[model samples]
Target chain A: MKALVWHGKEDIRYDTVSDPAIEHPRDAIIKVTSCAICGSDLHLFHNLVPAMLPGDIMGHETMGEVVEVGSDAKGSLKKGDRVVIPFTIQCGECDQCRRGNFSVCERTNRKKALGDKAFGHATAGLFGYTHLTGGYPGGQAEYLRVPFADTTHIKVPGGIDDEKLLFLSDIQPGDTVAVWGCGPVGQMTIRSAILLGAEQVIAIDHLPERLSMAAAAGAITIDFMQESVVDRLNALTDGKGPHKCIDAVGTESHVDFGQPDTVLDRAKQMLMAENDRPHVLREMIYVCRPGGVISIIGVYLGLVDKIPMGQAMNKGLTFRMAQAHVPRWTGDLLRRIEDGQIDPSFVITHKVDLSKGPEMYATFRDKADGCVKVMLQP
Target chain B: MPLTNVTGVARSEGDPRVQRKGPSSLTGPDRLARALGWFSVGLGLAELAAPGRLARALGLDDKEGLIRAYGARELASAVPTLSIDKPIGLAARIGGDALDLATLAPALHRDNPKRHNAAIAAALVAGITLLDIAAFKGVKAAHRRDGGAARDYSDRSGLPRGAAASRGLARKDFDIPPDYRAEGTVADAIPALPS
Candidate 1:
């Protein structure tokens, strides 16, 4: 089967990799119908992200049909059912999963999710990456092998639009991260403050499109390049600051907050002084109202640039951080999507076949095209 | 607590009798961690294979757990007079083959069509007897680590059931030492699903 494979530095290509099949009674093999490139994939393009090397399958946001199933999962799903799959492969009955933290399951991402020795490096995940993960292989190919078939898959409603459901994997949850970062979670820390239900959701970004999408999602848009986000959010909310303040832009933003090292060419790589790190997170802390919770989903490698712990404590703020339990949110989110409360697919600006992703990757890496999301067809 | 099947609220449909067995003598961490480890390995592969069924089955549990663990008990006990709904689909037959997902996948798919699934299907996966409404209510603030004064949380707002929840904590709000702490922190309720 042909899949979009990521070779060494900046080299993404479409090649015929071994096809995927159900090898376990608990497994289900899905034929790829639709997949997309995530913002994080750009990390691979820029060589900033490190994990699986060349020949690794890249795309994660995906939806497809069941071609085959192992014995145990057969009764729960059968041939020909469309489904939305999450990035974090998890078992439904684990302790962490019981608490709804499936992403950190001891068996999935052997090294990171459970730690190397816990599940053993090889005990974890899918295609493309090295054997460190189960290396069972991943979706970005003609077929994807899904483990824990009964617990990890989401049956896509039989007749909904595929385009709308594609983002269920990581993007929507990431978007939810942004929403929470700026909304309800933010409100948790800032008491009596307006919430994400605020009339204006302040989408902060240098790009017009993300800002536009944020506005489309009912937020007031703030282009950091054009206006002072702090000033604008305050103005929009009557000096109380945005009901919720989300940082979708993360450490990549120019003059990025919490980035402590200035010596590097750009994008504060090294971090020694906590305060020297850009002040955005802290600023968001300040921008938050008293008692507001801060919703964070940004990819901060380790400790944040500088967390305004003092103010957080002073204001009774709480910080909720996690990549997202997409499976956990699937049902409710699907309902919301069906109900028309949210339409995240509008974020997709580019769609390409597996072969075309290389150019998209290069362009996305150099910040070439205005690509919010690139959906790849196998 | 071990939950037993007893007469839940006899609804318009029908009620099932579930007996409260005892506090769920749930497994300890080590045991749970091992089970999770094995399940994670197996489930991850299932996801790569049968993500649709995988997601559906997962939702079924959490939904059921949420319902049985919270709603069932609350509903059944609150309105023992109400009737319960009948179980169908894979639910029709319980206590057999563990309703194994791998095996169930074929049936569920055979049951539906159209590119994996494009429909919403929910079922009553488990029975409930005692869902403490109070337990679902969020009442955290264990940070009083050093005997610092425990903040009075008996009057928080913006929560669906905050006032009611806070009212319960008012009595003990001051009793807890500032530093007196509890275990893990949890949300009172699932946030209104992300829009």
Candidate 2:
């Protein structure tokens, strides 16, 4: 099998690897048909997250037909079942899973001791993330071995295309909501807010293409490079600030001369003094209306420098964040897709063979050639 | 053994292992930059640990302190060179090369006892200087953004229904999950005080 492997910082390789087989009673092997290069994968590409050893396969957004199912998983999954594998792996029997906090579901991290040392408590195992999250080989290959397959997979219908079904594992909107970042996840968030009845959705980003796509979703766009986000957001909201703010850009905020703080954050990041750049978080706290909500959907790897907790406390803000409780909403979103309410395929700007996954990582990271989201076929 | 075999204690017998390596995301220039960065570390350590030996060999016995300072400079340049920001470190190396040549010029004089050794060191520095220049330019060119305008994606709304028609469409069947609601309905539910 051929898979994209993480070699080191800024080094991904399309390498031939041994085939995966069912290793546990609940495991299932799938012949992967589709996968994606997520924005968060850039973190691994840049070697920001720790515990990423060489030869680890790289991908999370994946869907495919099951070729083999272990004894325990045969009840819920079987051969020829098409399913979307969520990024976060859960046991579905833990107390956390019972309460719908699937991202923190217990009993999944194969390397729990290492995960506990790094994160205080081990969370759910994630496909292709790092050793701290199970060190499972990712789905950026011809086949993948899914653990806890009976509960971890989202069974999808055969008729729909892979693109529409893939983002289920990866939104709510409020009135006068402002979303930071306009990548694929951000773009989906924009449409979700509009569909959920937000009177106005403001999208923030520097890329013209991202801004334009947001506008097509009827969102008013803010090019952070061209104008002041704080000023424009306030003016749009009649000086009261937005009722809610969504952060889709996490950790690696764009380092630009305009956002001098981002420049400093990048310097600290290079020096190994900081793990995350919280420029977006800082701005969201500053610009959100008092008593409003702040939703974080972006993936932050570890510690962040200089967050304004004082302002959030004074304003009585509510912060909601997690790796998606995939099964909790995937079913609902799939129905919506069936009903023609939303289509997620629009976010894919590039589609190529799995062999080209290495170069696509570079292209997507640089945001060059007008590339936005990349979908890879294995 | 493959790297995975050594580090993959967590992996099971059935898990995938590397069979053959292929092309990497790192370009030729990026690999060159990394090699030079490691070279900088080696040279820097030698200069710092044995400045007296280096000075005596080059007939700069009186300039031990200066040689030590150059060692510190080499180590400093190596940091950025080894980092994702290679151009900065490469530029610094180019500057340091000029300094090395200037310091070695007087050592090449006919009267100097180690004039022959100084010539050899000077030639090495000149060779490194050319490699530094090439790596610097190659890195800059390889990582540069496309010179074309960004493609516009205004036609992609992702909403099958028009944006206006889709607003509040899900509200008919869905409500905000109780724990997720920000503005509390509990506050509104309470009777207001008489005005």
Candidate 3:
């Protein structure tokens, strides 16, 4: 089997590796048909997220036809069933999973001790993330070994495009929602907010292409470089801040002259002093309407500096953030896709073979040549 | 066994292992930059730890402090060279190479007893300087983002009924999860609630 393996910072290789086999009664093997290069993958590409060992396969957004199934998973999954493997591995029997908190399901992290040390408590194991999450080889290959297969997958019907189904691994907005960053996730978030009945969806980004995409979804666009994000957001809301602020750009906020704090954050990040650039977090807190909600779907790796907790406390804001408990929404989202309500395929801008995965990583990281999202077919 | 096999104790018995390596995302320049970065660390540590020995060999016995300072500079340059910010570290390295050449020039005078050693050192610096320049240029060219007309995605609304009709479409079938609802907090529902 060939897979994209993490060698070091900014080094991903399409290497030949041994094929996966069923290792437990709950494990299943899938012949991966499609996978994607996620924004969070860039964190690993840049070596920002720790505990990534060499030879680790790299990918998470994936779906495939099951080729083999363990005895325990046979009741729910079987050979030839097409399924989208959510990134987070979960034991359905856990208390967290029963409560719909699948991202923090208690029994999934195989390296629980290491995870506990790094995160205070071990969360769910994630495919291809890091050792702190489980160190499971990812699905960026011809095949993948899925642990807890019975409960960790979203089964999609045939006759749908893989592009629409691959994103089941990852929203809603009410009132006026301001989404920061117009990357792929940000674009999906904009459409979701509109579908979820937000009166207004304001997308913030400096890139013209992204702004145009956001505008297509009927969102008012703010080019932070051209105009003030804070002022424009306020003006759009009639001087009241947006009701909900969504941060899609997490650890690696774009560093620009307009955001001086981002520049300082970059410097600190280079010096190994800061884990995240929270420029967006600071802005969200400072500008969110009093008594408003802050919904963060973005992935924050670790510690962040200089968050305005005082403002959030005084304003009585509510902060909701997590890696998507994918199963919680996938069934409804899948129905929406089937019903022609929302199309997930709109976000994919680049499609290539799995061998080109290495170059695609660079193109996506540099945001070069109008590259937005890449889908790799194996 | 690969390092991952040893350290990834959590991995099950049937997981994949590397069979053969292939082309990497890392370009030639990136590998060169990394090699230069490690070289800098080694040379910098040697200079810092035995500046007196280096000065004596080059017949610049009075310049131990200067050599140590250059060592610190080398180490500082390595930080960025080894980081994702390779260009910055490579630029610093190029500057440090110039300083090294200048310092060696004085030691290369014929009157010095160890002029030959100084000349050898100067040649080595010059070689490394060329490599530094190459790595710097290669890295910049490899990662350069040229500005142009961006690919437009304005037509991709991803809504079959159009963006307008799609608004609140999901609300017809889905209610906000109770744990996730933000609109009806207890304080908002209760007018007499304290701030």
Candidate 4:
């Protein structure tokens, strides 16, 4: 089988590889159909988190068909069934799964626990996350072995078109988390504040494309590049601040502020705490209403410092973190997708083949490509 | 021994490369394999009764290794939800199990004139109930890992839930003290003031 493999920084190549077969009774073999390049994968290209080794298929977001099942991989998931996988490969049993922290399922990432000769690392494993994701061969290939398949992969409803449902891999859950994380999960979170069943959902980002897409999604888009989000955002709301706020613009994501330096101000500082770099996350926390919600969906690799613990403490503010539990909510998300409740397809600014990922990565890394997401085929 | 075991594997070609792949698919037996795979605070006698079958079904060649591995790493890998830090999210998480809105229509709410005021709160509750159904009732969104699979009601593995009283959420500090979930809270947090 041929697959895209990551070898060192900027060294991803499409190469032929061995066929995947079921090794565990619980394992299922999947013939890859489609996958997507994630912002986290870019971290590997920059060597930020390390271990972009040779022949490592680089991707986690995926959908495919069950070619074989290890008997243990059950629950009506049989040959020819289509499935969408969550970023974390988990066994639906265990204290973690019972608690919905499927990301840290006991069987998935326990390095020391699984014994000397085991499936993968002990830590929560991801597809093609290199060291972070247990170095599991990703699905950007022809055939792949899906361990704990029944637990990790959710079968999609038949008859749904592939192109529209693709965002379920990560983005759908991410968007859901934006609201869920900020509101209902607790009080005084940004997402709930900005989104509070408000007539207009206001969003602030430097990226025109993402901001516009957010606007199209019912948010009143504010370009931090042109005007300050805090000041200008009020006009969108009734000067009460956004009812809910979601910081989907992650650390690696670039915003095109009108300022020449394109430097981030409160937006970036509050979102993250630094050696003390702070912005986006904290800003979301800072800006929402007195009892509003703030949802932080940005990706982070390091510890943030000097968080507004005081602001969070005094205001009785609530904070909700983002983890895209897509597998858990796939069916509900799909209904929403099908009914046109949310159309994330608008976020797809560029389309490219699996072979063109490397070039797209370079372009995205340099912030030159207008690429927001790149879809791949196996 | 548990830690060194994996680094201690004897190589085999047919053995899984152990790299990540597309979101994989599942069969019926895989659900059994996944659930039975966990070894809780002591496997108890249940795991010992059926050794080989369970081991084979779960894809584990080393049973003792699994026990040790689960014992050593279980505390961390396991997502423990605490009771104290749980109040709000727990309420929301349990929305799936809560009473039907239609049934509670009388006591929880009275008739409305314009209905806009009551509708928003009702909508929020409805949204929470929907998510609770998805989150706790274990409904997978109608999508697959690889864009090819479909949803099946018969495809369920187990309950989908979040950590409420054990393995607390990572974002929050979980030093909530076990007693919080046990003999938690004094009565009357909800004021007795009349509406």
Q: Which candidate is the best by DockQ?
A: 3
Candidate 1 TM-score over all chains jointly: 0.57
The alpha-carbon interface RMSD of model 2 comes to: 3.9
Interface RMSD of 1: 25.3
Q: Write the per-residue lDDT of candidate 4 for residues B1-195, one digit (tens) a residue.
A: 222233442223452343433222222222222232232213323344454553443333355444343333322211111111112223333432243244224323444342454355356657655544443223122111221112111111011121111111111322222422211121122123254
Winning model by lDDT? 3
- The order by descending DockQ is 3, 2, 4, 1
Per-residue lDDT of candidate 4, residues A198-281 (tens digit): 334455554444443343333445656577766765554455554445665444433234442223432333222231223566
Task: Give per-residue lDDT, candidate 4, residue B172.
Answer: 37
Tell the DockQ for candidate 4: 0.02
RMSD of 2: 3.3
| Model 1 lDDT tens row, A1-378 | 677665543456666665555666898888888887765565444344334444456666767999898999988899999988787778777677776666665566534532353234323253333333443355666677777877778898876777778766411101112232222122221211122123333455555444443443334445665776567766766665543445443443344342333223132332122212234566678877554546655544323454668887876555656666667657765765675544445555577776676666644433334545667787
**Model 3: per-residue lDDT, tens digit, B1-195?**
333465554444566888999998999999999999999999999999999999999999999999999999999999899988899999999999999999999898879999999999999999999999999999998887645136788998989899999998887888678887665653254334565
Query: Per-model C-alpha lDDT, please?
Result: 0.46, 0.88, 0.89, 0.49
Q: Cα lDDT for residue A49, model 4?
A: 49
Model 1 spans > 4 angstroms off:
A111-136, A170-196, A255-279, B1-195
Error of 1 at A139 (Å): 2.0
Clashing pairs in 3: none
In model 4 chain A, the worst 10-residue window by lDDT is A180-189
> How far in Å is the alpha carbon of B93 misplaced in model 3?
1.5
Model 4 misses residue B35 by how many Å? 51
Better candidate by TM-score, 3 or 4: 3
* TM-score against native, each model: 0.57, 0.93, 0.93, 0.57
